[model samples]
Target: MSHNVLITGGSGYLGGDLLARMGAANLPPYRKLYASVRTAEQADGVRQYGAEPLFFNLKDESEIRTTVIDREITVVFYLIDAVQYEPPLFFIQALSEVKKATGRTVHFLHTTGAKLFSSHADAPTDRPLLDTDPQLYEIQKSQNPKLNVAREGVRTNCAVVEQAEKYGVRGYVFVPCIVYGKSKGFGEPVSTLRQIYMIVRAAKTLGRVYRVDSARPEWPVCHIADNTAAYIELLRKILTDENPSHGKNGYYLASSGSIAWDDLYDAIAAALVKRGVIADGSVTLASEKNVEDMGTALGVPKEMVPVQLGGKCTLSARRAREELGWKPAYPAEHILEAADGEVEWVLEHLRD
Candidate 1:
């Protein structure tokens, strides 16, 4: 494997999983794997996964060009906001340099969340959302009051996929739903699991469970390991498929199953009772309108509530499975199966 791989956000929840999974595979995936970290502290953490941590800043296009083009990096994995046109379209410029230097197709994996279609709806959609689903899109052009957002994430994601050819890169946007389960990599799983952690912690601290006033919303979910498996298989395809039919036109979504918000709340409530976190076994449903302040209502920290809480946020990884041969081993119905371990872990690793 002469492919040099560069993974941005290597110390993040998803990026850590990618590095750890690649390292644990039967055969080493990349001949040279560089894990790009924003800080020196994260660089040390990435080294544990056998990846040479490069303190690379996406804002620094010249350095990125040197890394991707000069170092001949064939695969670039963006676990964070690499799709954004801001920071001066750094990724496109970097890949353009690669194509100018070498005519080879530089595989770029950009991650975007299912929140693109997430809404404040009361019910989940009957079917999973496709990449091209217009009704489900967050941005609606024709409505009286258009659903145009100022800083839309899906906009950047779409731009990368639509403009990849012009920039000389094979772009694939990975859109995953609410991700859970134990992370395989060394870095702490922060962003995706923060809500659940807060819920569990707040319940235990307050001795009561909480739910929102909104109608039960469905949330698409995938385990961390299963999500990582999808990435691994996608990379394998990028490496082996010389002229794959999928080409640069594929947008991959990873979703094992969908769980209703009420059900998840019950599961957490049950887990709390079983774990002795909540006494008297009572659940308290909260109102979003009544309490503008989460701290006043539940004593939980104000870390912007995830849109998945709004419901109808379902997605299908069917495209990814069919195209990349991705088969998620984790069960969506059994996501709370890891609740026990997660509870203990979060309690022990609780940080402000």
Candidate 2:
């Protein structure tokens, strides 16, 4: 049976690009493509891409149920909140009902961050954690983070898998890392890559870029195109009934490789200095006052400054390549090369 798909967060950086590229992806046959939008303007914006606009409050369980069941949306790409489990649970249950009524295999893909699998969440950082590891679900469940966001994210990811399994709905945990590059979408043209953007914003406010971690920790990075391609490839696999791994076995990390946060900081700092956004390109460890000031700039607590700006996430991207035949066009270090352009783009879009 042909699948009817619904993709959420159409107005977001990743979702808008996904929707913009969906029409040209040349995927296996599907019945229809729908994009969720919050406003009439966004609804009109998505129509240009041939996606029917789906209007509903994502937080309202009844609305989610009605929207998914009535439309028979077999595939859901949830690009919205990663820390919230309620909406995904609702979507999974709704998809299960749709499966019961039509006997069609339904899929729910949740877009979570690589941070949830990193040091902040107490995930193992001594070795590379492959996305396809058999014990990843257990690893995720074992994570006990003091950081509120990491704790919530870990709980949400596990809950999504557990709920999907209980309801017989195929679920995937899609992890996006420090994705950078120009966003090729009608909405939210600037990338919401907090790690990179935080450096620029905090620098502008503090008059310099500060490193929260004394040790140069490495994290995964991906280009915007490569990140979107991973999403499309997974969808392609699902539409063709290839039955790609789901539930606990379906962790897909969309990173080309890993880069040191120090390297990223230096690259972006040089770019800022060239633009005269900061006084110097020298990167320094954040003093207590600097972290507090940075926190004030980021509107997050001082403790969360490091969590948001710097951390070690050794989550490797093997499943997408091995399972979906996905190949990233850009390398991980490409973000460093693109730092100047990325800074300009982000600066142009920074409202505050």
Candidate 3:
């Protein structure tokens, strides 16, 4: 069946990269491409990439249904921040309806973060957690994150899978780790880089870089291009009806490998010191008061400071490699090598 695809968050870092690369992806034949947009300028922005801009209230179930059913969008790539269940449920149900009406398969790829499978969310940190593990869904279902927001995110991941299964739609949980490097899109091409940004913000306030965790914890990392490539590969599989794994086993982590958080902190610190953003390049352990000050700088609660900047997330990438034949062009330590450029770009674009 010819498939029409809709990509939401088309102006975001990941979404914009997807649109930017779509022209060169050499993807399998599909009917049409649509990008969810909010303004005339954004609509024009997506049009540059050969996408029909779709304007609809994602929160309104009826509007979402109308938009999807009318456009006959058989595939959706949801890249927006979705810690709640309602929006994704709306899309899944709408896609299921499309499947029923036309007797064609529909797919939903929900973009979630690596944090949902991290220590912050109470995911196991004792070993490398493979995305292809048969028990991954159950593990996600059992997570009781200490942070209320993270807990919601974990639940949302489970809800997407369960709801998609109930509605007979293919669901994929696309996980992007600590993705770095510059974006290649027409819109705002900067990643939020929340963790790195927090460190910089806190350092500026405290005059030095501070370590949120004493024992260096590791987290998965990915380059922007490699991350976008993984998404494209999965889309290729779907378009070709390869059935690249869906439902509970559809978790795809787009990461080269894992890196120590301390290594990242040190690299950024060196760059910041060279630019005089921080007085000292040396990384120091965060005292209680330091944590509080950092929280104030970040405008988050003190308890959430570590959750934002530190903690181990050993969620490994296996499914993307084994199933989609995806490989990262950048290695695990490439983020460290690119830290100088990353700091320069981030400093230029970061706003208070």
Candidate 4:
């Protein structure tokens, strides 16, 4: 018998891409694929990918109870917003509901990010992050509130894992870096890359060239396609009961390659220049006067300016590779190339 898979946030970017991939792979053909969305319009869009759309607000208790009970969903891909709801409350409630309804072993895939492991204090300049490293875990416990939330997320994830083992459900958690690639709907905002592109364009328009410094820290990036591939592989293992050790309720960092931020900036600039969006490469970082400006320009906090400017965000994906047999098709540079293609396509199609 085929299992039913329910993907929360299915109408969103990552969910839509995952649905598209599942359709293409045709692996473990789910008896039913249910996607949760907030609006009828979003549900309509999700149907384009051949998924049955379920409109439900994640915060509503009745909706949650109704959906989980009604669907009898055996496998759930919880890819909802990380920053929106309070982690402890949101997760506890959702997990409780799912656990109550599905008495059988349910597979829960919780999505997280590498930033959850990052140090808020003047970012690390030394080496790439590792999953088993005690130091990384220690740093995660340090001063940052966001990291603290991440710690709770780990706890919540582990709780589900333990519950799965005790109650015969299977649960796994995924930690990914900046996920980028092509998709049907607008994915997470590409604010940082777009800012870099704009700065390059401005410099080129003035006929001045500025070179990006290579000494800046490297940011670990993964193509959305490759990230989704890892997810699919993990899901397949769960469905077949092939290797319970795969993902195994532990944290796995998903990164394709680590490229210095300055190098990324230069690449975006180069792409802009190639498209005649700018004449030269003289670009600079945006002034940090307002919080929104910082978020809009860099996709991070204003306080993190120094750390980001210091540029040392690098992570290792050896765990993902060895355990999950996952490999990113595009490296960091190539992913940027794909992103540039996305931008070019946007400009070409949207422009007059």
Candidate 5:
């Protein structure tokens, strides 16, 4: 079977991992693998991994549809956040139209974070959400977050699946947690974990870090390399496996562990203290005043602290393991080990 893969956000951490892994001959052979990048510099980034870089502005839905249709690209891995929803909606709509005009199944895997049934604030627990679990998957949108853009991402995946059922456009959704790792190809920071940047900055500015809610909110997390492997495994199966291209079979989770963002902050603070930058090796939590004053110095706004370090959100990868034989090599028990590498990278790049 001939396959041509097109990955959006190829210059990004996850996509760069895919590109580098492909370059390393990790995934099955494809006729061509093109990485869609916006800038010339971004294009150069993917070129190192031997991907044919395609420069196309994704905001223009017509352009995106044209490129997909023109190239006859069989598979697409969309890593961009649906913070901008219209382009993605339009892109999927065009694929649906293509299926209507000519019967061709284009497999699309979209990345949406595991904030779907989250901000389930009033009730917090140690139980991790499983994709096989109906409760979480059943609730698509939530009224919890006033500005719930992530909910819209889930809706987008739903719409794409509906189109697949109606017009035969194959679609899948991948929900990943806070991904940690420096990219193998470009060494770019995983932008999803803004907490890493904030914590490091807090340590630098105040010689310590702050934690709220006692630093014990379990949150879903994954290493960059492991998450990338899950993506590739799913991509490989979508093409070769007998899997249908809609609904839960099309959805996956890419998390191996959970740790409170507060705990992660503690590690960062301890690292700084051990380096003699901070006076003590402990986390401090003053009033919101501390965050407000340090916000100016550290570029972290005070009001955003609570939202960034909110309630616990855990996920289970059981279905991915049972179905695709995927397991996160770096489980929650070992997140600190990965954090050691991450802290070293953050200190060298972010705090420097």
Candidate 6:
């Protein structure tokens, strides 16, 4: 019996990368991969990988049940955002439809972010968050308003996991931090790579560079290829019922390593210098006034100015390695190189 998999958000950056990897691996012989997209063009793009693309909105219950029910969708890879101060009830409803259709024995892979866990200056150094740690719940309660929505997501995910266990469905969630790689569609503009591109582009023309403050924090980062590999490994384990890591049904953070904002900025500057886009790495950190000026220059919102200047948020992926046997092939520098290549390609084709 061939395994059938349905992936939501198939036209996004991560989905595009996952589809590309599936094409490369050629695993799950006779795999019937279904991708849901918003537009006909996006559906066509997904079909290039030999996967069936279905046009359906995540919010439509009837559409979900109609498309997913009666289908032997043994595994599901959900990559929709339900947190980050966004409304994600539609995703929950869709998942409910899948649960209702599959009778809970289906393998559900939910994607989340590592930001669910919080950190503070007073925390003990040796008390890093563990899978069994219960402190995260408290920290989640005290998060900023923008992150309060994540608490609901976490609660919903926990409920789903519990329901899956109760109904004999296998569930797993992966929480990644700052995924970056070559993008294929209209990707979100606030990604780190996009910020880097804007800064590098500005530096090239303005003869000055922008750098974020180093003292803020370090962000955990992962390469798209590496992240995709982890997802594939998880999918294979679930579809085959192999209990790759002893049937652990909880959240796993996916990150290669952590890098300071200043370090990342320097790397992007170096890439721009290598490409001759900028004469030298003589860019200065954008002051508050410079940020406003640059926002106007770039035609982006001034409120997003601080995002480029923000520091990293740290996360650990040791659990992903120990449990799923996953490891990132490319480190931070290599990931930046991959992103720079993407920018260079875009510039070459888009340049008049």
Clashing pairs in 4: 204-279, 204-280, 210-281, 217-311, 217-312
**Model 3 Cα displacement at 340 (Å)?**
0.5
In candidate 1, how many clashes are counted?
1
lDDT of 6 by residue, 1-352 (tens): 4456888867676767777778776455644889878887877878887779877766665666566665656567877663422223333344455667655445666776654443321212243455434444344434543433445655555555555556555667677666666654333312433445566555655555676453546667787778888887777666566664322435666777776666666766777777777777754667777777766655655555554444334446666677667778888666555656655654553321
lDDT of 2 by residue, 94-147 (tens): 999999999999999999999899999999999999999999999999999998
Q: Write the per-residue lDDT of candidate 1 for residues 1-352, one digit (tens) a residue.
A: 7577888877778888788888665543557878888777888888887778886667777777777777888778888663356532566667767767777677777776666545532213455556545333333222121233313564565566656766767777777777776676667765534456766655665566666535676777888888888888778777765443232345677878788767767777777778776765655565553223445334433333333233366555676676667788888887677766666666666654
- Candidate 3 wrong stretches, greater than 4 Å: none
Please give, for residues 81-124, the per-residue lDDT of candidate 4 as tens digits.
44343432333344445657655455666776655444433235
TM-score quality measure for candidate 4: 0.75
Model 2 residue 8 lDDT score: 95
Q: Is candidate 3 or candidate 4 better by TM-score?
A: 3
Maximum-lDDT candidate = 2
Q: What is the TM-score of each predicted model, taking all chains together? A: 0.84, 0.99, 0.98, 0.75, 0.87, 0.75
User: Candidates ranked by TM-score, best first?
Assistant: 2, 3, 5, 1, 6, 4
Spell out the clash pairs found in candidate 5. none
Q: Every model's Cα RMSD, please?
A: 3.9, 0.9, 1.0, 4.9, 2.9, 4.7
Ten-residue stretch with the least lDDT total in model 2? 189-198
Number of the top TM-score candidate: 2
Q: Model 5 over residues 103-183: C-alpha lDDT tens digits? A: 656677777776553553322245555766654434453223444454455566566556555645577778777777777
- Model 3: colliding residue pairs: none
Tens digits of per-residue lDDT, candidate 3, 5-114, equal: 99998888889998999899999999999999999999998999999999998788999999999988999999987587789999999999999999889999999999
